[model samples]
Each structure stands twice: as structure tokens, then as C-alpha cells.
Target: MIKVAVILTGVLLLAAYLVLLERKLLGRFQARIGPNRAGIFGLLQPVSDGIKLLTKEDVIPQGAHRRIFLFAPAVVAATALLTFAVVPMGPDLHLGGRKIPMVVTDMNVGLLYVFAMASLSVYGVVLGGWASDSKYAMLGSIRGAAQMISYELALGLSIVPVVMLAGSLSLVDIVDAQAGRPFILVQPLAFVIFFLSAMAESKRIPFDLPEAEAELGSGYHTEYSGMRFGMFFLGEYVQMQVLGALTAVFFLGGWRGPFLPAPLWLLVKIVLVVTAMIWIRATLPRFRYDQLMGLGWKFLIPAALINIVITGFVMVGI
Candidate 1:
């Protein structure tokens, strides 16, 4: 119970600040100042934003399905948070002669659990958009769902090689397998594919066709406002953090580094992965819808398949 509370609080706080961090980085990338008004360097900006969202008027569009519209955003936020349950941030700690694992729950099928939660988040987008009774919202949700589903295939495929090499689905076991060297060194191709696919799955820029402002009018959340909309926003950043953490767990040797506490090492790696993603968001343009689907199906999927085959051969040969 204590572990769950700590993880939930930590993840929610991180998600809130991640928005500020992205804004600051983006301002710099654009050669301008970011949020420096709310507090010293806008340190309290997320707090102000939270207050505003909470106090703002929550609206339900006329003719909308009120229950589903209200419920959908929670689905996204909940699934994203739940996915963290199996993510081990550091090695076990011995306290009072009791062994405490770093993760909330280290399921043997941790990888699959993560994927299942990710897959469930799509329903929030679809249901929210559909319940809104807005054509724009419906279109955005459809595009978002299709894009997420398409990229998921590549994302799932990209990790097969990692599982083959690790010979276990448990994330802790995967980390243990990498003690000699990170998988990024051995499965470079899988790493690249997984990274790209993850960005797409998270609906980051260049893969953000679903939320294209000019086209979708703010996309699936077009009809959302106040704290309701905030939940949807929270889900995106949280998903980014979740994917960043997964990337570290799979490729960077989770929590493993010399001269640092294990959890701090994992935090450092997650920040690096997330910063790179923000850079990509600032540097790249949204892809044309066809191009987005094409890259996932024609390129990433095929590359992942080939990588899996090669990994299998290497494992058998050695």
C-alpha cells in the first residue's frame, strides 16, 4: 500500500513538471524565454496551471453522452499510471531484515502487462471522441486510434529481440541480463526501432497526426475543458515518462551505473530519453498521415522482424 501511494504521487508530480520542462526547452530551442513568470524560473508554473484547471468551468457539450465523456479521460490517466506498477526503478532494499523490491509489483509478465495497459489507453481516445458528438473530435479520435494501433505492432515487434536475448519477460530479469553490457550495445537496431515506435505510440510530434491543430481543431480532446481536459493532457506526458522509463529498462540497463545510487541512475537515463524526445518534437514536423502509417507498416515492422530473426540465429549459434 505504501509503495503504491509513493509511486502514484511521484508519477503524477513528474508528469506535471514534465510539461514545464518541455515548455522551457522548447522556448530555448526557439531562441526565446520560457515560463519565468509564475515563480523563480516558473518553478511553480505547474502548480498555478493545476489550480486554474481545477477552478475552471467543466463543460459537457450539448447532445453529448455525459457519462462517457466524463469518464474517458480518467481511463487514459489511470492506464498510464498503472503501467508503472511493474517498472523496477532500482535493486531491492533490505530493511529490517525484509526484502523490498523497488517496483510496485514485479510481475513475471511485466512486459506484457505494460503493453496491455498501453493498448487499453486507446479506448479512452476513441470513447471520448465519440461521446463528444463533434465531428472534429470523432475524426481526431479515429486518427489517433488508428495511428496508435498501427505503431503498436511495430512497438511490440521491436521488443521481441530483447525478450529473446533476455530469455525472460520480467523487466528485472531483463535488467539482470544486461549486467555485462546494455542491450543498446548489442541490439542497436532493435533499440532504434523501439525508440521510434515508442515516440509514435506516445503520439509525439512527427507522429502527431491525430492531434494536428490545423486539421483536427485540437483533435480528440477538442470538446474537453478544465480539469477534464487536464486529465487528457496529464495522460500524454505521463505516457512519455512511462515510455522513457521502459526504454531505459529495455536498452540502457535499468538502474545500473557506477558511482551513483541505483534509482538516481534510472532517473538520469529517463531524463535523457525524454529530453531527446522533446528535441525531436521541436526539431521535426508532423508527418503526413500516409507517411506515418507507411513508416510503421513498411519500415519499422519489417526491420523489427529481421532483427528478431537475426537475434534468434545468434542465440542458437552461441
Candidate 2:
């Protein structure tokens, strides 16, 4: 129970810091100053934001489905926290005369664990949207479900080559295979598919159609207020960080570095991956809904399937 509490606390802390990093990165990229007033370079922005959300008045729509509405944000946040359980930050290090690995729970079936938890996370958005009894919320939920399901097919298939090559579904084993040579080199197409699908799954910039502001008026969580609204927002950013960590574990070689200690190495790799995500967000414009759907089905899926076929033949020939 203590370990669970500790892991949960750590995840919350990491998620808070990630929001600051994203803001700072976006500010720099856009040539506009970010939140420097709250704390050091707006380091206190998250802190202040949390306080504000906590103190704000809670507003539940009278016509809304009350039970599910109360449950949605909590479900999303819990799912985000659950994923970190299997995320190994580094090798065991001796601290205060005890060796401790920086992961929560590295189950034997790490790959399936992540996929299962990831599938569960989408339900929060769908449920929240439907419970709101608003057109925008319904549309947003529908879009979220369709988008997640569509991309997950390609996303799941694209990573199969990595599994086949490594001959293990364990994330730790996958990292081992890419230790000396990153998977990005051998499976370039898979990397692209994994990356794009990851972006869609996380619902950032180009793939964030469900929450499109101009069209949907804040989309699914528009009816939510107070800490409830905060949960959804924070959960999205945390999901971004979690997905970035997964990318590091699967492709960038998790905690595989020299000179720096293992934990530091893990942090460095995650920062790089998260920075790239922010860069992509700043550079690309959001895709139209229909265009987004078309690209996923027509381009990404086909390319990922080809990547798998190519990898199979190459492996058999060898």
C-alpha cells in the first residue's frame, strides 16, 4: 500500500512538471513569453492552477447524468496513473543500503498490460461526453471512440515487428534488443507509424479533433467545472507524458545510457521525446476531422501493414 501511494504521488508530481515544460516549450517556439510570473519561469503555474481548481465552485449540470458525470474524470486520471506502474525508470540502484528499481510494477506481460490499460483510458472520454447531454459532448465522445479505435489497430500492428525481432513482449526485453542499436534504425516505417499513432492516441495538436475548441466549444468536458475540469486537462497532459515514456521504452532504448546513472538517463530520454511531441504540436496545424480519418485508414494503416510484411520476409531470409 505504501508503494502504491508512493508511485501514485510520483506520477502526480511528474505530470505537474510536464505541464510546465510543455508551456515553456510552446512559449519559446511561438516567440511569446510563457508563464514566468507564477514561479521561476512560471514553474509555479501548476501549483497555482491546482489551488485555483480546488477552490473553485463545483458546477454540475442539472440535466446531466450525475453518477457517470462524477465518475468520468476520476476514471481518466486513475487510468493515467495505472500505466506508470509498469514503466521502469531505471535499473536497480543502491539507495540507503537497499537496492530499488525505479519502476512500480513490471509485470511479466508488460506489453499487453499497457495495451489493456490504454484501451481502458478511452472510456473516460466517451462516458464523459455522453453523460453531458450536450451535442458537442456527444460528438466529441463519438469522435474520441472512432479515432482511438481506428488508430489503435495500426498502432498495435506496427509494434508487432519490434516484438518479433526482440522475441519478447516484455518492455524491458524490447529495450535490451535496442540497447546498442535503437529500433528506429531497423524499423524506420514502424517508428513513424508508432509515433503518429501515439500522437493520435494522446490526442495532441494535429489529432485533437474531439476537443476542437472552435467547433465544439471545449468539446466533451465543456459541462464540467472545478476540479472535475482540472482532472480531464491534467489527465490529457499526463497521458502525453506516459505515451512519451512508452516511446522511450519501446524505441529510444529505456534507461540505456553511459556516464549518467540509470534514472538520469531515463529522464533525459523522456525529456527528448516529450520535447519532440511539443515541437510537433507547435509546428503542425490541426487536421480536419474527415482528413484525419482518411489519413489514418489510407496511409498509416497500409504503411504499418507493409512494414510488418517487410520485417517478416527479411527475418525469414536471415
Encode model 1's per-residue lDDT on 1-318: one tens digit a residue.
999998888889888889999999999999989999998989999999999999999999998999999999999999999998999989999999999999888899999999999999999999999999999999999999999999899999999999988999999999999999999999999999999999998889988887899998989999999999999999999999899999999999999999999988988898899999999999998889999999999999999999999999989999
After aligning candidate 1 to the native by TM-score, how far in Å is the CA of 212 from where it should be?
A: 0.6
Measured on C-alpha atoms, candidate 2 has an lDDT of: 0.86
Q: Give lDDT tens digits, candidate 2, residues 181-228.
A: 888788888888998998898888989998999999888898999999
Q: C-alpha displacement of 209 in model 1, angstroms?
A: 1.0
Per-prediction TM-score to the true structure, in the order listed: 0.99, 0.95
Quote the lDDT for 89 in model 2: 75
